[model samples]
Target: MRMLLQIAFIVAAGYGALVAAAYFAQAKLVYFPAVGREQVATPAQMGLPHEELTLRTKDGVRLHAWYVSVPQPRGVVLFLHGNAGNISHRLDSLAMFARLGYATLIVDYRGYGRSGGRPSEEGTYLDALAAWRHLTAERGIAPEDVVLFGESLGAAVAAWLAAQVQPRALVILSGFVSVPELGQEVYPFLPVKWLARFRYATADFLKDVSCPVLVAHSRDDEVVPFRHGERLYAVAPGPKSFLELQGGHNEAFFFVRPEWERSLAEFLDSTRPVR
Candidate 1:
C-alpha cells in the first residue's frame, strides 16, 4: 500500500512539473534577433531598388526593415514575417512582391534582427504599429495605400492592428486563429487555454476589421494546421479570400504557386483607391 501511494505521488508530481514547464515556456517559444544569415536582394535580383530602413518604436527600440519600391506600385505590402529569423530570411518573398508590382516593407519585430526589446505578443504588436506609423507619418503613405501582410505569428499582430487601424487590406499567411488555440494544439494534454500568458487572440479581433482580407495557408502546413486558417477566414467579417497551396510551414513560397501571387494581386487591385 505504501509503494502504491508513492507511485501515485510521483505521477502527480511529474504532471504538475510538466504543466509548470509549459506555462513558463510560452514566453521562451519565440526567439528574437533571429540567428542566421541576413539576405538582402539587390535591384537587379528583385527588379527594384531596395532600401534598408531603421525605425524607432514608441519605447525607443530601433527596428530594422527593408523597403522595395516597384515602378507603378499598386499598393505597399507591409510584410510582418513569421516567428523565426530576421528580415533577411524573407528576401525571396520581398523580391516576389516587388516583381508583382507591389512595393514591400519587411520589418523585423523587436528583439529580431538588430531591433531591441524582448519578444512578447505585446512587444511584437507595438513593433508592427511603429512600422505602420513610420510609413504613414514619416514617409507620407496613406492607410489606403498600405496592405498588412503577416505570416504565422506575424498574422496575429496584423489582425490585432487591423482591428484598431484601418488599412486597405490584410493578408495572413500560415496563420493560426489564436495563440491559445495553437498552444492547445501543440500541448493537447495541458490546459493551454487557461494557462497561456500571451494570448494573441486574432480570431476575437477579426470581427472589428473592416477591410478586405486574404488568408493563405499550405494544405500540409506542419507548424500551424491548415484548419486554423480556414477557421479564421470563416470568422473574418469582410470581403475575404483563401488560398491553399502545397508544401509545409516555411516552404509555401518555394512552389511558385500562381494562386498565391494572383490572389494577393487581385485583392490589392480590387482595393486600390480611386484617384
Candidate 2:
C-alpha cells in the first residue's frame, strides 16, 4: 500500500510540473510566426492590381499589408489571416476575392511578414482596430461597406473587432468557440479551462455583433473540430449564415469555391448600402 501511495505521489507531482510549464509556454504554442523570405511573387505577378501598405496599430506597431483592388468593387474585405505565415502566403487566396469584384486588404499582424513588434492576444485586437482605421479614417471608406473575414486564429480576432464596429458582414473560416475551449480539447488532463492565457471568446463576441455573420468550416477538418463551428453559429445573433464546406481544413477553400463565392456575393449584396 505504501509503495502504491509513493507511485501515485510521483505521478501527481509530474502532472503538476507539466501544467505549470504549459501555463508559461502557452503563448509560444499559440503564435507561430513564419520565417521571412524574398518576395519572389505577388498578386500582381498573378495578374492582379495590388498596392503594398504600411499600417500602424493603436499601440504603434507597424504592420505590412496588401490592398488588392478590383474595378468597381462591390465592397471591401478586411482579411485577418491564420496564425502562421505572412500576407504574401495568402496572396493567391485574396486574389480570388479581387476577381469576384471585391477589394481585399490582407494584413500581416505584427511580428509576421515585415510588420514590427511581437504578437499577443491584445496586440492582435489592436491590429484589427488599425486595419479598420486605415480603411474608414484614412481611405474614407464607410464602416458599413467593409466586411470582416477572419481565418483560423484570425477568426477570433475578427469576431472581437466586429463586435466593436459595424462592419457590413463578419465571416470566419476554420474558427473556434474560444481559445480556452480548444485548450481543453488539446490538453484534456490538464486544467486548461482556467490556465489558458489567451481567451479568444468568439461566441461571446458574436453575441454583441450588430452585422451579418457567415461561418465556413469543414467537417473533415483535422485541426479545429467542425462542431466548434456549429456551436458558434448557434450562439451568434441576428443574420448569421453557415457555409458547410468539405475537404480538409486548409484544402476546403479549393473544394468550396462555388458556395464560398456565391455565399459571400449574396451576403455583401444583401447588405449593400443604397448609393
Candidate 3:
C-alpha cells in the first residue's frame, strides 16, 4: 500500500509539472515569430510594384507593411498573415489579389520580420488597427472598399477588427473558433482550457461583425482541423459564404487556386459597393 501511494505521488507531481510548463510557455507555443524571421522576398520579386509602409501602433510599436497597387483596383485587401513567417513570404497571395484587380496590403506583426516589439494577443489587434487606420484615415480609402483577409492565426485578428470597423467583407482561411478551444483539440492530454492565456475568440468576434463573411477551409487540414472552420461559419450571422477546398492546411489554397479564385472573385463582386 505504501509503495502504491508513492507511485501516485510521483504521477501527481509529473502532471503538475506538465501543467506549469504549459502555462508558462503558452505564448511561445502560440506565436512562432522566430521561424523565418528575416525578409527573404518581396512583391517586386513577383513583378509587382509596391510601396513599403511603416505603421505605428497605438502602443508605439512600429510594424512593416507592403502596399501593392494595381491599375484601377476593384477593391483593397488588408492581408493579415499566419503566425510563422513575415510578410515577405506572402508574395503569392499579393499576386493573386492583383490578378483579381485588388490592391493588397500585408503587414508583419510585431517581433516578426523588421517589426519592433514582441507579439501578444492584444498587440496583434493593435497592429491590425494600425494597418486599418493607415488605409481608412491616412490614405483616405473608404471603409467599404477594404476587405479584411486573414489566414490561420491572422483570421482571429481580422475577425476582431471586422467586428469593430465593419469593413466591406471579412475573409478567413483555415481559421479557428478560439485559441483555448483549438489548444484543447491539439493537446487533449493537457488542461489547455485553463492554461491558455490568449483569447482570440474568433467565434465571439464574428457574432459582433455586420459585414459579409467568407470562410474557406479544407477537410484535410492537418493543423487546425475542419470543425473549427465549420463552427466559425455557423456563428457568422448572414451574407456569408463558405468555400471548401482540397489538400492540407497550407497547401489547400494553392492546390485549388483556379477554383478558389473564382469563389473569391464571386464573393468580392457580390460585396462590391455600387459606385
Candidate 4:
C-alpha cells in the first residue's frame, strides 16, 4: 500500500510539471515561423507572373506580400497561409490560384517571411488588415469581388476579419473550432482552456458572415481533427459547404487534386458576374 501511494504522488507531480511547461511555452508552440529562410523561392520559378508587394500595417509593421495576377481574373483571392512555413513554401498554391483565373495575394505574417516584427495573435490580425487594405485601397478591387482564403491559423485571422467586413466568399482549410477545443484534443490533461492565448472562434464568426463559405478537411488529417471542419460547416448559415478530401493534413491539396480544383472553381464561378 505504501509503495502504491509513492507511485501515485510521483505521477501527479510529473503531470503537474508537464502542464506548467505547456503554459510557459504555449506561444512558442502555436506560432512556428521559419525566420532565416524568407525569400528562398518566387512565383516566377513556377512559370507564373507575380509582382512583389510591400505592405505597411497600421501599427507600422512592414510586411512582404506577392500579388499573382491572372490574364482575365474573375475575382480576387486574398490568401492567408498556415503557421509552419513562410510564403516561399506556398508558391505552388499561389500559382494554382493564378492559373485558375483569380488574382492571388499571399503574405508573410509579421516575422514569418521577410516581414518585420515578431509573431503574435493581435499582430497577425493587424497584418491581415494590412492585406485587406492593399486589396481595396491599393489594388482597387471591389469588396464584392474579393474572396478570403485561409489555412489553419490563417483561417482564424480571416474568420475574425470576415465578421467585421463582408467578402464575396470565405474559405477555411483544415481549421479548428477554437484553440481551446483543439488544445483539449491535443493536451486534455492540461488546463488548455485557461492557458491558451489564441482562441480562434471560427464557428462563432460563421454565424455573422453573410457570404458563401467553404470548409475543407481530411479524415486522415494527422494534425487537426476533421470534426472541426464539420462543426464550422454546421454553424455556417446558408450557402456554406464542407469538402471531404483524402490524405494527411498537409497533403490534402495534392491528394485531392481534381476535387480540390473543382470545388474551388464552383465557388469562384458563383462570385463571377453573369454575362
Model number with the top lDDT:
3
Model 4 whole-model lDDT (C-alpha atoms): 0.84
Model 1, 1-275: lDDT tens per residue? 99999999999999999999988877777553446425444444645588878888888888878888888788898989878777877767877787678898888888777676778777888888998998899989999999998888888899998988989999888888887889898989999999989888878878789999988888889988989989999999979888777788977464256666776677778888999
| TM-scores for every predicted model | 0.93, 0.95, 0.98, 0.93
lDDT by residue for model 4 over 182-221, one digit each (tens)?
9888987788998887777878877888888888888988
State the displacement of the C-alpha of residue 75, model 1, in Å, after optimal TM-score superposition.
Answer: 1.3
Better of 3 and 4 by TM-score: 3
- Per-residue lDDT, model 2, residue 190, is 86
TM-score of 4: 0.93
By TM-score: ranked, best first: 3, 2, 1, 4
Name the lDDT value of residue 90 in candidate 1.
76
- Candidates arranged by lDDT, highest first: 3, 2, 4, 1
Give the residue spans of candidate 2 off by over 4 A: 35-40, 252-256
Which segments of candidate 4 are over 4 A away from where they belong?
1-11, 252-256
RMSD of each: 1.9, 1.7, 1.0, 2.0
Task: Indicate the TM-score of model 1.
Answer: 0.93
C-alpha lDDT score of every prediction, in listed order: 0.82, 0.86, 0.93, 0.84
Instruction: Please give the distance, in angstroms, between residue 256's alpha carbon in candidate 1 and its true position after superposition.
Output: 3.4
